[model samples]
Target: MPPADDIVYLDHLASTPLDRAVLEAMLPWLSATGAGNPHSGHRAGWRAADAVEAARAEVAALVGARPGEVVFTSGATEANNLALLGAVPEGWPVVVSAVEHPSVLEMLPELARRGHRTAVLPVDRDGRVDSADLAARLEAGPAFVSVMAANNEVGTIQPLDELAALCRACGALFHTDAVQALSTLKLDMRGQGIDLLSLSGHKLYGPQGIGALVLRDGLALRPAILGGGQQEGRRAGTLPVALCVGLGAACRLARQRRDGDAARLRLLRERLFGALSARLPGLRRNSPADGLPGCLNVTLPGLDAADLLLDLPDLALSTGSACAGGRGGPSHVLLAMGRTAEEAHGSLRFGLGRGTTEAEIDRAAERVAAAATSS
Candidate 1:
């Protein structure tokens, strides 16, 4: 294993370094040759519009959705807000999983203020939602249900198909925040029965500030943002041509390399886990063994995760959700999975990426184990 001073990064869940191919694809759009405005009928504008449409088709292909169904948003947060707020009628009840991102959690207050009922479905010790409980809630008639395809903190893959079926049986719409699952899993929008799906570009080796919401046809909801007519009036703003191009290219690359990437990442993850567990006998893995391919959360009992992170500057990692960074609180996801406050506070998340190598994983495990023991 290499020395800890090498500065290996393993926080891909927080964000990924942009792929070179994606960056090159976006470069023309950022320059004068790119479309100035997609709305214009002029040659430059039409060319830009053509680029945007091409990217849209690429994004749609990755998820098995039509180009028309993909609505560009600022990121997954905006996409989630659009999906959740747009799908329901005024004053209807809503249900979301307990382990959802703060964007979804924060929206509950506004929904309540608007006289809409909200229910948070709980998860088991493994951080998986109870389908029976979800079905029961749906039977009570919520307008829609939101569940993440995979957890960001603990990396538990939800039974999206079963949940979608339950929502369908009750005639409710189903949405998934697939920001963390985009490159890690195979996404089939129609096959999964997902009425709405949110994805972030930065999470999949694309540029930030761009994402998309895939909505089923004829699903009506009010627009969250109102401005110049864009994105077919579902979302209103000037399209981000460069970011869109990057996202589309990243999606295409991911589709091409998904199987090979998953196999390599799984091997790296297991080796890291096995090495760390052997070095530190009391170490516990927070993520499920069968969860997403490249994410792992582990708890080192009696060690403060924040302290461990700060002490190990050579390793870039996270205590839990990067969205909760600077908040100084235990992970809500870990708590939902039955971890004690101390246990939750003792956790760290290691998210592997395309650039991560087996040697890097081994070195990271050794450094992490050393940090845990010293702390």
Candidate 2:
């Protein structure tokens, strides 16, 4: 029943293929332009710096932030770490969602070691943080609150405006990891009242090894990495001019194609889900109905997700969080949403991207249904 021996990548949630336009934009900075450190004051260095600034502006424009507010980082993980650790005032608590990414979860142990109180707000079955419960937790006083813009595993979009309003009322800083949501969803930093936001280049069809953190004006965050005066001394290092340019070009392209892409992906996603459900009547969709257009998380009764994935090599997918894929653990996102360990283990995430086609989705759906039925 499954297709034979041909690979069709459907794991966009893990990472996306780089756009040709983005690659073309980056080609000039990689070698032809001259190797000059962005921190240096020489002519070539200034040229590189100018390109970095232009990229910064493009990234800022994507999320409605000023260029000065964007701080380059290695990736969204680093950006999240910087935003959380750097922005938290001394003696204040930190509150993060229970379904946060592993980077945020792992940081809690260290924060506890440093004598910072940390609380994890629980989510509903839909994988959304309960605003009322979050408010209750924050009643203790000022604390930095971080909730991701969207759930990576489940693709559930968070109510950022409500969360930001709550943080503002509690006089606390708010941060969002927008890595999974960026370009897929339209965002306005000012309108949402978000103090900090993190984005990764790879998630938006750009190069890896680069990301940006947008900070609210006048918000002073202590520098975690100290050295040369790059990134306005916020994040210290030579800027990756080529990767930055790629990110900028990717952002511009994403903006141009977002509406049409979303519509197309949504149709394909529905078709895929419908096909799978029709074939396996007991199949359950894990992601929320109103979630992001391109992502779908589903579970088939009596099937081991890892085994199913292994059997269907033609259809690339994930058992749960890509970060925790090989570890053989129940998904924390599902557990946070009140699913049992068995249900969590049976779930798989299918993330559609700009390159995904109707034929590919159909083939993938057939493979998934075959796997589920066979198991």
Candidate 3:
């Protein structure tokens, strides 16, 4: 079914291939003259700085933020740490969803060490955060609540607007790890009551290791990385102009094509699932009907996820977050939803993206089904 055993990338949730348009936009910055240090004061630096600012503007527009509010980072992980540590005072209570990304979930130990009490909001069977439980937690008075806009593995979109309103009523700041929501959802930071947001470029068809933290106006952060006082002294590092350009271009294209792309991806996902489910008996879908259109999580009860990968080498997929790749453990996301270890380990996540094609989907489905039936 696959054309010449070509590798089909179904792991877009982990990372996407860089877009050609983004590459073209970044080429200028890769040139010799375009390689000036953004911190330098000379003409070269000014030109490099201009490119970075233009990129910043584009990323800001993507999330309905002002250019001045965006802070460049190595990636979403750093951005998340900055937002959480900056807004949440030591000894203040903080609440986060149980299925949050490791970037958010891993903060608990450090926060505990700092004397900040942490409470986890549990998710329903559908992987949606419990709004009523959140209300009960707010009674304890939290300094902030960190909930993701969408789950990276299950693609379940959270009721962020409602959550934000609840946080506001409780006089608590709200932060969202929106790395997976970009390009697939309309993000209006202020209108959505999001005090802080984290994003990644690679997840949106841009360069890896480059992301931004969009902060609300008048929000201040203690510098997580101290150096020569760059990025208004909030973060100090020599900015990468080419990567910024790529991220900007990616954001621009994603904003322009989001609606159409979402519709197309949804159709492709259905087609893939339809084809595979018809062939593979006992197939179970983990993602819900209201999940993100770009992602599908499913389990073939008797098939081992590792064995599935071994059987179909041409289709790139994963059991869970690529960040945990090779760790050989059950997905915490699935486990938190009450899946047994067997079911959790049997799951595979299909993350469709902009360049995904019907042909590719058909090939992937056929291969997956054949493997499932034969295995």
Best by lDDT: 1
Q: What is the RMSD of candidate 2?
A: 1.9
lDDT (tens digit, per residue) of candidate 2 on 109-154: 8888878999999899999987898789888887888999998998
Model 1 residue 134 distance off true place after TM-score fit, in angstroms? 0.8
Off by over 4 Å in 2: 1-5
lDDT of 3 at 182: 88
Better of 1 and 2 by lDDT: 1
> How many residue pairs clash (N, CA or C atoms closer than 3 angstroms) in each of the candidate models, in the order given?
0, 0, 0
TM-score of 2: 0.97
TM-score of each: 0.97, 0.97, 0.97
The Cα error of candidate 2 at residue 200, in Å, is: 0.3
- How well does model 3 score by local distance difference test? 0.88
Task: Please report the TM-score between candidate 3 and the true structure.
Answer: 0.97
| Tens-place lDDT digits, model 1, residues 1-375 | 437557798999999999999999999888877748987888888988898999999999998899999999999999999887787777678899999999898899988888889999999988999999988887667568899999998889999999998888778889999999879689898888889999999999999999999999898857898988788789888898899999999999989988888888898889989999999999898899999889899999898989887777888899988888877889999998899999999898999999998888988888888877887
Model 3 residue 87 distance off true place after TM-score fit, in angstroms: 2.7
lDDT of each structure? 0.89, 0.87, 0.88
Off by over 4 Å in 3: 1-5
